[model samples]
Target: MRGLLKLTLTQMKLYLREPVATFFTIFFAPLMLLLFGAIYGNEPSPLFGGRGSMDVSVPSYIGLIIVTVGLIGLPIGTASAREHGVLRRFRATPLHPLAYIVSDIINYLLMTVLGVLLLFLTGKLVFNVRFEGHLLSVLGGFLLGTLAFFALGYLVAGLAPTARTAQTVGMVLAYPMMFLSGATIPWEILPKGIKAFAQYIPLTYVVRLMRGLWFGDAWSQYGTEVAALVGCLLVGGIVAAWTFRWE
Candidate 1:
């Protein structure tokens, strides 16, 4: 337990020390929100059932932030560590493998939660957006979404042979999902074919679930999205665990 705590803190500190990671993980989402919100300024939209654009934009950016960390940050960090033999050195120690992986994951998750809070606060304070639903339900949806993406991150990290390859793979996966999964563009405004394609993407489910929870959409109506995210969590988690390598 002590070792896990130490590793978690160390991983967190390492992430904080990286300027790019610190900026994207902590600032980018809120900055994006501020930029778009300034242009759109709490305008009610028929696309989101007349809620302010910031409301939809804020939650979507939350998903984008998580995807950024999971799909790009984790994979690059893991592959770099592996390529540099950090994982091998850890294996030579007395610590269990789970401790190392869990610590890193938890560190990323904490950063994600912090990012979400910052984005939400910025949306509320600057754009006058408000959550119309229960806070706990929103939190539940966030946790589920985070877990699903974290598993995907682990899968990517486990499979990539080097940091460069991991980054290339992560970008290939991340960019399309960011644009098409309703993270940046409103899904209702997307073309029919694009919407159809988005239905198959895991990030789409996450964004929908988060948006629904934020707007007080009944949890009963979200069974399919919840199920899909849970399935991704299970499949990705198992594959990542099975494929993980020390060297």
Candidate 2:
């Protein structure tokens, strides 16, 4: 446990030292909130079911964090480490390989949580964003969505032959989701054709699950979303495990 903790801390420090990672994962959502909040002013909008724009945006932005960390951060970091023989070196250590994987997971999860908190703080402090859901329910959805994405990230890391390939693939998959999944823009405002396309995107489920929970919808109301995410988690985990390599 001590070794795992140290590894997690070290991984976190390394992550923070990467300016692009820190900026996008930690600060980007909050900056988006400020920008949109300034433009929309959190006014109760008929388009957003009469909720303030910031109210809906804050929860949706949680998906943004997940996408950035899970798709962009994890795949690139893991692949780069493998490319540089970092994972190979860890194999020589006494600690199990699972220790390295777990530590990286912990590092990414912690960063995701911090990013979410910063988003909430920005919304609440600047726009007084309202949250109507049960905290536990929102938390459950958050964890489920995060794990689903993390699994996909690991799958990407395991499959890509090189760090450059992983970066290219991750961005290819992640950027479209950011726009289409309603993580960057509200689903209600999307074009009809875009909304139809977005339904096929996995991150759309995360956004729907999060936004519904944040609006105080019961868990039972989100059966489709939950099932989709669970499917993603199971399939991604199994495939990533099979394909994963130390170097």
Candidate 3:
């Protein structure tokens, strides 16, 4: 247990060591959210109904922004480490294998908190957005979304053939996720086929669930979205645990 803590911290510090990569991981997703929010941030959402348009969409966008960092950033970073022999080296150490994943998870949780707060603050200052939902529910959405996505990252890392391959895959998937998750293109605006395509993407509903929390929305409002997130986590978690390798 103690060793895992140390390993987790080590991976985190290493992540910080690459200043550019670190910055991209921490700020890029949020910046994209802000840019998109600024462009369409003022509009109403069709999915989240009954309230005004602006009221429902902001939080889901915020959640989408944060999840990208964890879901997208973690896999790329881990893949880089594995390619560079970091994971291979770690396996020879006495520490637990879980340490590798746990560390990335911890780093992302911190990133999630910071990203959400910073983006929210910026939204309030620049975009005039504010948190309106139940605090506990907002928190629940973030936690569950984080866990589900964290598992997704690990699963990606576990499946990649090499670190270089992981980076390529992460890059390929990132835009698809952002687009389908309703970051760049709002889900409602997409065609039926595109919307059907998005249903398979994990980040979409995770954002929906988080945004729902922020709006103080009822759970019933999120049936399809929550169900999708749960399904992704279950299937992805199994694949990650089964396929994850140290080297």
Task: Work out the TM-score per prediction.
Answer: 0.97, 0.98, 0.82
- The 10-residue segment of model 3 with minimum total lDDT is 48-57
Root-mean-square deviation of Cα positions for candidate 3 versus the true structure, in angstroms: 3.0
Which scores better on TM-score, 2 or 3?
Answer: 2
Q: Write the per-residue lDDT of candidate 1 for residues 1-247, one digit (tens) a residue.
A: 9999999998889899999998988899999998888787887878778887887888888889989998998888898899899999999999999889889889999999888889988988898887888999999999999999989988888888778988999989999999999998878788998887788898999899999998888889999999999998999999999888888
lDDT of 3 by residue, 34-75 (tens): 666666565544564544334545565555555566556777
Error of 3 at 66 (Å): 4.4
Instruction: State which candidate has the highest lDDT.
Output: 2
Off by over 4 Å in 1: none
Pairs in steric clash, model 2: none
Q: Regarding lDDT, does 1 or 2 come out ahead?
A: 2
Give the lDDT of residue 232 in candidate 1.
86
Name the TM-score of candidate 2: 0.98
Model 2 poorest 10 in a row by lDDT? 92-101
Clashes per candidate (backbone, < 3 Å): 0, 0, 1
Candidate order by TM-score, decreasing, is 2, 1, 3
